[model samples]
Target chain A: MSATNRQIRLAARPVGEVDPEDWEHCAGPVDEPGPGRFAGRTRAISLDPAMRGWLDDRPSYLPPVGIGEVMRAGSVIEVTASDHPDFQPGDHVVGTFGVQEYVVSDGRGAMKIDTSLAPPSTYLGALGMPGMTAYFGLLDVGALKDGETVVVSGAAGAVGTIAGQIAKAKGCRVVGIAGGPEKCAMLTDELGFDAAIDYRADDVRKALRRHAPDGIDVYFDNVGGDILDAALTRLAMHARVVVCGAISQYNNDTPVKGPSNYLSLLVRRARMEGFVVFDYADRYAQAARDIAAWIADGRIKVKEHIVQGSVDDFPETLQMLFRGENVGKLVLELV
Target chain B: MSATNRQIRLAARPVGEVDPEDWEHCAGPVDEPGPGRFAGRTRAISLDPAMRGWLDDRPSYLPPVGIGEVMRAGSVIEVTASDHPDFQPGDHVVGTFGVQEYVVSDGRGAMKIDTSLAPPSTYLGALGMPGMTAYFGLLDVGALKDGETVVVSGAAGAVGTIAGQIAKAKGCRVVGIAGGPEKCAMLTDELGFDAAIDYRADDVRKALRRHAPDGIDVYFDNVGGDILDAALTRLAMHARVVVCGAISQYNNDTPVKGPSNYLSLLVRRARMEGFVVFDYADRYAQAARDIAAWIADGRIKVKEHIVQGSVDDFPETLQMLFRGENVGKLVLELV
Candidate 1:
């Protein structure tokens, strides 16, 4: 079986905003499935802030993507060719398949998605990596308990939306901090959040004080900047600040804005910890099952901000995250 | 018994250095032992940096010492009179008996000390609160393991000296930071520390880099500020910074200089935690036994910087800590 694949490769590392010249579109013929590998047609791609970190050459959790390698991404693909024992052709699969029209993998870190339950992009968003990040970050790392108040920044983004829902399901009073009124309304109305702070209009610290009268027990910080400083002020005793992502300072020309009010941790006996989704790999099965059950019960809302585009449009699609233009999850549907 | 008891009372809170005007000496009649009470004559008073935190009118783990109350101090006292069956007249005891020549207590939070094994002064200095703070802070809070590198600030002081010894005893490489060359020499030569960084004479970060090239696994910080900043830059993965005290910033008229490099906690997956000694009250028996055993075997050296003075000299005794004039555990022996 011959499959033509259109791939987006990193031409150069971006300076600030990723320029169009930074990515090059390359087309090639996809080969037959190897002894253990399978070939699939790509459907939707996931855009994440960690994608920016993977581009910079520094000692981080992961190495930088090489210039010649296909731009790293998590995507949903339709399985068309398979020779491995675990899978068959026509099965819907999801994994880190890069920015390509077709993907061939050796069944490592790949999950079979039943679109009959949720859409293909949903597996790439709410039920996948970002979902797992929010789950473990708030519940395990943050040590969230019932009746505790949770305040999540980037409340309308992929991780924040899922985190709020998970905390709400766990019987927590959840408050969300989002940029616009629309996103704020979406957090409170669409998701089961107790309160939403419009950070664009209201003062973050004052909003936190009003919403969390007893102070926040858990702070799920995705956009770390002045907002993180604002949250630091209202942390209660034994509060946990989960550092899932720092979107606010990822593209900073200078150093990231260090939280000046960190002494609050000492005063409140609080803790701030960071986590990567890879650590939760062994427990994903249980988490995915729980999330799927929650979705089936209409307890969690799945929001996918899908952009219909070709492989060359990958760089532009990623910019949507930095600009805060995408709602729930930003996905590039290969055309 | 008509004992002429001299008690140091807090006259006023000081703005910077504690002055004689801040304290008032009262010559009062010795409190007689009532039913189920014991009257003890103070032998040695434990002068600790934590005594400063008790003077502040802010909320902490314990209630602040009131304006006209006797200054709180841990003391080794010999019971001169007893109406309680649990304690005898000749029994040596360790308890928070205030800065006074005589004390009367109902035997709560008071542990009987045996002078047959060690000196009564050792109960207030080494085998006492400072020793317990060092043991628990280094082992429990710091989670120290064998073969790891331990860096301690205020290395010549009571808690620091014991912490360094305990880390060394656990088969760890220990580095200490002290004010002068003499204290540095005492730390390495006398206290069994692997290396000593004289903060007054050498660059602390440079010394740490040279000594603990693999990065510090645990840092017990007593003298916070730039020393804490230096230690922050050298933390290994999952490093624990035990906030035993911050004496360096205690008497500052200005706000404490916070360590700006604290984000190293995130980069290294480290933590900084504060705890009051009272939190481990139930485990003091375990600590005293272990520390006394270590001292007996010469695994830990017991050093007491005893200042022979009356209760009226309490203000001047407290100032020695801020001035860094005393080494090991500073205690006031009533003369």
Candidate 2:
């Protein structure tokens, strides 16, 4: 085991796009598990669009990461030492373990994972927060019905891919909207999406009208902006717009652009609802079992873009999400 | 009865505000009731903000008023002649009778109203479509709970007055937003709203925060411009925004200013839903009963700005609604 741990701490509150100077990389003495605690080495860290929201000094589902504090993150860690009763040495756990090489926890909000079922990275990707987010955001908040047509924005991202697949598994026709032709092709060709719209190449509203000719019954929004407005214009009667995240607007210096065509909700008798995944913590195990079953049956495919790096690479890897550089679940795997 | 029926027809679709040139004042021969039909003399016409949306050629809850057609309006009429089974002379009825001095109907959408309980103009205001809109939009779409904090925009207008009072009747703390001080004062003093914000005089966001310090549980949005944005910022967790109308943006030549702070919905885990009151057609009777009981018990107050004029006055009276010139319900009563 390493005698020292490397960590990334927030140095400044970003104005718009997060800058390198905003993060401070430093080394510190590794924490030892005291009474009723366990220590672990982080194997993988999740890079999410929601991370951008946490960097701002504002109120949200979770409190902002304060300056001089380790950046808040969801990661998979392997236990190295333990004074806690439940956790043992070598057990893999998933939790909000922050952007660090080592962690000490009291088992509050930490869950032990079976590495034999899937790798540690898979837990951070398919069986972790993103998976639970797509599960409840679509099925619960979205109130999705079988055979309904669904349109997913940021379709190549973590939650979007899972949301689209869950819709397909329920016998619904799914259309994906992603930034590039390659991402669009991956959505349709590999992920079982009924159709894909390269937002960079197509007039999204017109494309949506053609692909979802009957109008989208459920729009799982991850990239909010003109794409959300496009989805609003093509909603069927009583459509459900699931407000999951707004990756496109996360780095904006100005205000988040609201959907101008949102009044279409009135004309179509539709609704737009926002939800946080943590609210469904009690049902995470059930959602995981269902997701696991789908993966085993070949109905759901796990997609992860693993970048091998140290904790210092987190700031750049996170920027990739806003720039739409990575596909599916973007993760940092420490060597 | 007069030898000719005076009518106001749509001349051209207005680009921004409806101009005098957009209306055609003409006279037509009064038609007799045909087989299985009825004829009536228009008693009072309801002026609504929704009329502007009907003038625009777009897909909406209802069809646009075609050029050269009688401008669509909801009015109360006194039955003068009938050939149908359910019709009789001297019975008062309400329906979408258009901006005309006389109306011929097959009794399709007509409802017989009791003038003994309320005046004919009151039927066009408090006991009519506006009343039902407030009832269903607040109780159903808003999912309002007793003792909750409720904020209403356009609170001195027809629907707003009723909505505010209904919220007050439910034992909720009601805050109203209107254009001028008089309208704001009317909301608090006469209509039973707990507080009022004059958007023209005060900083709306600051007023909302001060009035609804704990956060707004239900926001019944009737004017969806900056006021809607202001309400969005003050939402409590699990808030419901009922998009009843956007009178502020109805006549804008430019695109509607979308609520820039709408992402507050995500941060607060709230929802914004839109509904057409016509969808609750089957439940209007029940809703009207509740509203009527409240009014009778003095828990609700009826306010109307009645303009006594002929059919030629319809154009000017309708404009009073857009200018925020009238308080409570604005109605043109035919002499």
Candidate 3:
């Protein structure tokens, strides 16, 4: 075990695209587990689009990570030392463990994750918050019905990938909107998406109209702005737009574009609802059980783009999400 | 009865503010009632903010009124002749009778209104489409709850006036935002609103923060530009924004200013839902009955701005809606 813990801290709030200067890499003495406390070494870290929102100094589902603080993150940590009754050494846990080599917890928000069923990285992907976000955002907020035509933007990303697969598993026709040819191919060929539109190459509105010929009944929008506008224009009657995240507008220096075509809600008698996954904490266990079963049954496919480096690699790994370089669940595995 | 029908026809689509050239004053032979038809002389015509949306050539809840066609309107008509099974001569009815001195209808969307209960102008105002819009938009779309903080824009206008009163009737704390001091006074004093914000004088966001200190639960947005943005900023957890109309953007020569703060929906885990009253056509009867009871019980005050004029005055009367001159429901009464 390392005598010192290396941590990446927020140096400044990001403006438009996040810069390297916005983060600081520092090392501190590793804390010994005291009474009712547990210390863990981070094995895998989750890189999420929502992290960008947390960096902004504004009110959201969670308060922004203040400057000079260890950056807030969702990570799979292996308990190396423990004094807490509930958490034992050798047990793996998942929680808002900051971007650091080690984490100390009171076991408040941390949940012991079983790695025997799946790998540690899988806990950061399909069995984690992104998985739960896709689940509740689709089923609960969207009120998805069987045989409904579903469209998802940012379809190659973490939540989008799982959301599309879940829609397909539930007997819905799924059309995915992604960026490149590679990502689009991966969506259709590997992820079982019925159709995938490369948003970079095709006219999204036209492609959506062709793919979702019957009009979209459930639009799981992770990318807001123009794509959201396109989805709005093609909504079926009583469509439910699940606003999980808006990655497209997160890094914008200008104002986030509100969907001008929102009036489509009135025309189609539809609804648009935004949700936070933390709101569904009580049902996470059932959702995880269902997701695990689907994974075992081959109805869901898990994808991870793991960057191997120290905690210092986080800034670059996060940038991959905004650049649309990562294929699925982007993660940082400490080496 | 008049020998010729004096009609207002759509001459051209308005660019920004509606101009006199957008309408054509024409005279046509008054059609006699044929089989299963009724002919009626217009008693009072409804002038609505929604009329602005109908003039634009766009896909909305209803199709845009075509050039050279009689401008579509809702009016109270006194039946002069009838071969229709549902109607008889001397019966007063309400329907999409168009901007004309006389109308012949097959009773498709027409409902016979009793003037003994309320005046003809009231049917075009408080007891008509505007009334139904407030009822359903507030209760159904807004999903209003008692004790919730409700804020309404265009609070002195037709739908806004009725919506504020209905929210008050349902035991909600209501705050109204209107353009002028006179209109604002009407909202608080006559309409039973808890507070009123004169948007012209007060900084709307500051006023909203002052009035709804705890945060707003239901926001009934009628005038949708900056005021909508202000309301978005004050949304509480799980807020419901009822987008009944956007009169502020209806006449814009440029693109409509989509609320810049719409991301507030995501931050607050809220919803912004648009609704057209016509979509609730099946339930309008029940809603009307409830509204009538409220009016009879003095829980809801009816406000109407009646203009005594010919059908040709419609172009000028309609302008009153955009100018924010009328205090309540603006109607043109043919005397």
Candidate 4:
């Protein structure tokens, strides 16, 4: 066992946006597996915008992380030793294994990953939790239909990339909203989006009006706030607004302000439903299989933005998510 | 042809609540029906709270009543003569025949009624348009299920009365919100509700907590404003809030105030949907047949409040509604 292992821990509660001071680097000895526990080394750590919400103390679908705890993260790891019968040494496992190079697990939430079909990093992106989330959130919760116009915000992010692709595969006209020209270009050129609106420069409402002239049938909202209101104004009758994430408002110091024009629900007879992907854990394999099939057929493109860094870079990498710097799935490839 | 006929015309638009000055009595000669029409003597006129919305110039699901027009109403009339193949002399018909002593129609929007089931007034009450509204709104839009807890506002009104009875017949435990002790007593005793809350005297939230201690499954809201918010707070997971009519807020001079606690929809994973009864016109006959079967089998009881008056008494009879003096269905029987 290694005498020294380094991990990033939450040093303080972040205010507004996360700062480097919010984390503390610690070194400790890697532990061997007990009777039921297994140990692994983290290969890639996922950086999701939802992590910002987990850092704040508030009422959400999940509880916030306590101070001094290993910062919460989803990771692709290789088991070096195992005691559990369901797993073995040299098996690639994926789970919420925290911000560390080495992790020991009881195999409670870990899942064996196939490195042949894609790679360890793809498990942290297109064929993993975010992909399954986009699939279920769009298809099951949104109840998307063929030829329906889909408007997705945070369109360059992990879930958004897969969501836009899945909608396109379902015979839908997809509109992507992202931050920069390059991201918007990637959405249109690479991700098969019909239209891409740079939320940084364009008026969202005007862009939505122009791109989705028939009005939005399903608005997959990852960036909430003004974008949500803009989408609400352009909803067709019986439209469904899927609240997958609210990256824009998650880091606010004050009380989260909701959209004011929500009466559009009554005016348009539309519905807005919020769901957590964790709710569909048992059905994730179904989403993964379908997504993999689509990828195999060249109907869905996989995009993962991998950053090479040490475990100590976890705090800074998470900050990149809130700043809208990373395109597609943002993940830290551990050295 | 009857030369003597009297009608009530809209005199002035009410700024808030309808007052006596808002109505005008006008006399007109009763015209004879043409080759494809029927002449009916107006026996009873239904007074519904929704009639207030028709007076406004704003856009609604239905067109607003034009200035200086006959006040719109659902009428139970006895056919005196007919050239229409579907209607015959001495046949009782229900139509949107306005507030008048006589009406002539070319068989359009008219349905023949059988007086053998109940009395002529009950058609304007328990088995009429309000009854159909309650039936379809509760069953189809609300998606009510057996043994669910149903909380309805305006519990002593025509539609509310039948809605509670129908829910009871479907094995739902019903709670009603009314204005006074007498109305509440009738809702519990005569209407067979599980409990009744008098909103005028009692606190709505506390009453709901006491009556529906397990949380509400379906909320049939007829009176909006604070009552809607109160019900929204008590909704269990996946609860359906049916927006039938907002009687309490109909009198507001400014824009109707929306409920501030609507974030509850997100919290409960519930839905709040608004529907106009006219949307279900194609399925009214189907709803009527099912509702009639229940009434015939003694599963549901009919309640009617009849007020006998001359055509000139229309103005005064309408005031009885705003005063909350009538129970069940408030029908003005032209005597």
Best by lDDT: 2
Clashing residue pairs in candidate 1 (N, C-alpha, C atoms within 3 angstroms): none
Model 4 misses residue B241 by how many Å?
Answer: 3.8
Q: Candidate 1: where is the Cα deviation over 4 Å?
A: A1-42, A66-70, A78-92, A100-107, A199-217, A224-239, A253-270, A310-325, B1-41, B78-92, B100-106, B146-148, B199-216, B223-239, B248-272, B311-313
- Top candidate when judged by TM-score against the true structure: 2
| Clash pairs for candidate 2 | none
Give the CAPRI class of candidate 4.
Answer: incorrect
**Sorted by lDDT, highest first, which candidate order results?**
2, 3, 1, 4
DockQ of each: 0.22, 0.81, 0.67, 0.19
Task: Give the TM-score of chain A, superposed on the true chain A, for all candidates in the order listed.
Answer: 0.97, 0.99, 0.98, 0.98
Interface RMSD of each: 3.2, 0.9, 1.4, 3.7
Question: What would the per-residue lDDT of candidate 1 be over residues A191-210, giving only the tens digit for each residue?
Answer: 97999998889999998899
Per-residue C-alpha lDDT of model 2 across residues B112-215, encoded as one tens digit per residue = 99999999878887788899999999999999999999999999999999999999999999999998888887887777788999999999999998999999
Candidate 3, position A86, lDDT: 93
Write the residue-wise lDDT of candidate 4 on B92-205 in tens digits. Answer: 999899988988998788888899977788777777788888998799889999999999998888889889999999999999999999999988887789999999999999
Identify the superior model by TM-score, candidate 2 or candidate 3. 2
Q: Comparing to the true complex, what docking class would candidate 2 get?
A: high
Clashes of 1: 0
